[model samples]
Target: MKYDVAVIGAGPAGAMASKYAALNGAKTLLIEEHASIGSPVQCTGLISKAALTECEISEGSFVLAKMKGAFVYSPGGEELTIRGKDVKAYVIDRKLFDRELVGRSIDTGADLMLKTRFMGLHHGRISVLSSGERKDIHADIVIGADGIMGSVGRAAGLPRCKKFLSGIQFEAPYDACDAQFVEIFTGNKFAPGFFAWAVPFGRMARIGLAKNAGDRPALHYLEELIKHPVLASRYRGSRTEHVVGGIPLGAPERTVKDNVMLVGDAAGQVKPTSGGGVYMGAVCAKIAGEVAARAARKEMDIKEYEKKWRSAVGRELALGMIIHKSLGKLSDENLNEFISFLNRPGMSECITEYGDMDHPSVLLKEMLKGADKMRLVRLLGVAFKTLF
Candidate 1:
């Protein structure tokens, strides 16, 4: 088969990329290894409201719950509530959500190929195993929207993301304090260099954690998490489902090499602070698709994709990385002090006004301008001080 652009993986990034490619007049081919789209769901499915807008999706049946705010817990058990005046995010059903995205791509003139596994790229041709048949597909440009494993990138001799976090999650019944508030846990005991969460949807929640590279497995930390006083009090000890995955952070130096381009997790377009990719991924994928289509027609250089996407999100991603590292290095005692400071009068109001899940850097900037800036500087220390 011959096409102007071939996109591997039918996830959100791939779907969006192919849709834009076709909409831009490219003959786009969207391929997925799974027989059905959105199988073996890997994400916690919590997405910011801006994420839906970025993906060009409205509130659909795939939205299980709308979240207004979050309850954050320190290792020492101090609670800090970041209350949003309006809906801030959504808890979604990934299976239905992903299918909806891919369906949109198909409707936008992109051809869909199920059970198609990308084998390699050779001499500008794509080798694939489709429906038990080996075939070669020719395309002017190949877009890899695959997951962090990045088979397409490896085939194209691209470098990997700088680092990865091990993550695990499960769905279970829980006695929720508030259905509209997601709970966030921070400290070294349960999550080490990362954090754990209980995202409530009705009487149930998705409980999960992501940790930096470590000697102990994520499961070990998960076991400790459920034993925490806060989680133990509400968790019912019954699990309905489970998911395990890796989240990549730190984009590679380049996302494009010759005719091949990478987007989404394949290019490390995820936020280091929250480990969420859909927002940033969608942003980059749109650029990748438009550039790929134009490049395929020889109207633009494939490298334009790299330039455009980074310009859109590079500073935010860099700031997020700095924030992630600063928070990750705090000791449990320091976390308690930090949370206590936030619990002080007048601080919560500031957080409520500027807090954003998709852009923590904005809140950070606001805090740096506050009267308690010195206190924050003392708590966050040298690393974060560099941001100023």
Candidate 2:
């Protein structure tokens, strides 16, 4: 089959790209290797309210719970509460959510191809294995929304993300302090270079953590997490579902090469601080789709996708990387001090008003404006120098 644009991967990013491509008059094809979408779920399913708006979807059957705040625990077990006046995020069922997105793409005139595995891209020809048979589909432009492994990008000889955090999680029955608030745990002993979390929905919680601990598998940390006093107190000792995956950070120097463009995880579009890619991926996918459609018609260069997407979210991602690196470097004692500083009088109010899951730089910038700025600077180490 031949199409104007062929988008590989049917995740949120691929679905959005195909939808925009079709809406822009391109004959778009959305390809997925799996027989279905959203299978083998790798995400925590926690997404911000702004993510839904970015994806252009209303609250649907996929939303399982609404979150209004978070309870952060320092290495010393100190609690810092950040309460939002309104719903800030949602816990969703990724299967239903992904299907909804792909359905939108189909409705927008994009063709869906299931059980089609992208073999490679060669000489302007798209190759795939479908129904145990090799086939070739022609397309003027290719958009890769594949995951962190970036199969499509690799085939096109693109550089991969600079770093990857090993992540593991399980869904289990848990007694949460408050269903409307997620719980965050921080310390080198547990997560090492990253953090752990318990995102609750109803009586169940997705408990997991991502860490930069080299050589030691994430499962090692997962075992430590469940034994923590906070988690052990609430965990029912039985898990219903488990997820293990890698979260990529640090986008490569280039995301576009020739007629090919990369978006979403393939392009390292995830937020470094949160390991959340949906919001940023959706933002970039729209640009990739539009640019692919135009490039197919010779109205634009494929490079425009790179420029447009970066202009939109590059600075935010860069700043998030700074914060992630800064936090990852802190010793347990320093972390305790940092969290303590945030727990100071009037500090909770400042955090509650400025804390944003999507754009952490805003909160950091605001913190620098406060009188205790020097304290925070000392806590962040040398990374603070590069943040601004």
Candidate 3:
């Protein structure tokens, strides 16, 4: 089979890319290894309202749980509460959300092939394994939207991912959940490299943790976190439906190569700090789709795809990686101090704004002013030292 663009994987990234490519007049094909689009859900699905607004997604699309505030728990049990007058964040039903995204792509005229796995790439042709049959599909350009361990990336010779976080989340029916606030627990005992979260999704809450590069299982860390004195009592009788997965941290060495572009988890576009990629992935995929369409029309250099995407979102991701690394080094006491400092007056608002997945660095740089300037500068200096 032949196509102008062949996208591997049907995740949000691939769906977005294919949707745009097809919308731009390219003959686009989207392939997914799984029979279903969003089965085996693996994300906590917590995101800021800005992301939803930018994506043009309505709040009614998924199970919406409004978050008016957040609570940060220090390892030593110190707590810092950040409350907002406006809506801060929302917890979503990832399975339904992902399905809606893929469905939109299909509705936009992109062809989909499910239960098909990408085998390899040879010349400009891709070999796909479908129902015990090996078929060679040719395309002018290819998109790798496969997850962190993407075969398309390997085949394209993109650099291997350097950082990873093992995450485990569960949907539990809980009687006592602060629907207006999301709770974050920070400390090595609960989660290393990342903080654990309790995201209220209506009647159920999603609880999870991301583990650092050690041999420890994320479940073990989750077990410890749920058993924490503050959380144990509330979660004692919750009914749990578990979701476990791994996420890539850090920026990709190169998101584009000859005749191919990588998007979403395949290119490690996830926010290193929060491990959220839906917004970033969709934004990058939108750009990649336009670039691929132009490339197909011989209107632009294919390499321009990398240049555009990197300029648009790479710096924030780079900064996020540095922050993630610095956060990994903090002890319980350090987290307490950080949270305490953040809760002082306007600092929490700054931090929340910086946590915007799109322009993290802009808000981060803004937070570097005022009384906490020295501390913020010190953190950036450490980030620079570590990243360089």
In terms of lDDT, which candidate is strongest? 1
CA RMSD for every model? 1.6, 1.6, 2.3
Predicted candidate 2 versus true structure: per-residue lDDT over 215-333, tens digit per residue? 57888888988888898999989999989999999999999998899999999999999899999999999999999999999999899998999999999999888788877877788
Models 1 onward score TM values of 0.98, 0.98, 0.93
Candidate-wise lDDT, in order? 0.93, 0.92, 0.81
Using lDDT as the measure, name the better of candidate 1 and candidate 2. 1
Residue-level lDDT of model 1, residues 273-341, one tens digit each, is 999999999999999999999999999999989889999999999989988887877778878898999
Q: Which stretches of candidate 2 lie over 4 Å from their true place?
A: 382-388
Model 2, position 86, has a per-residue lDDT of 94
lDDT of 3 by residue, 227-292 (tens): 887778667556578888889877667878889889989888888878888888888898888889
By summed lDDT, which 10 consecutive residues of candidate 1 come out lowest? 379-388
Residue 197, candidate 1: how far off, in angstroms?
0.4
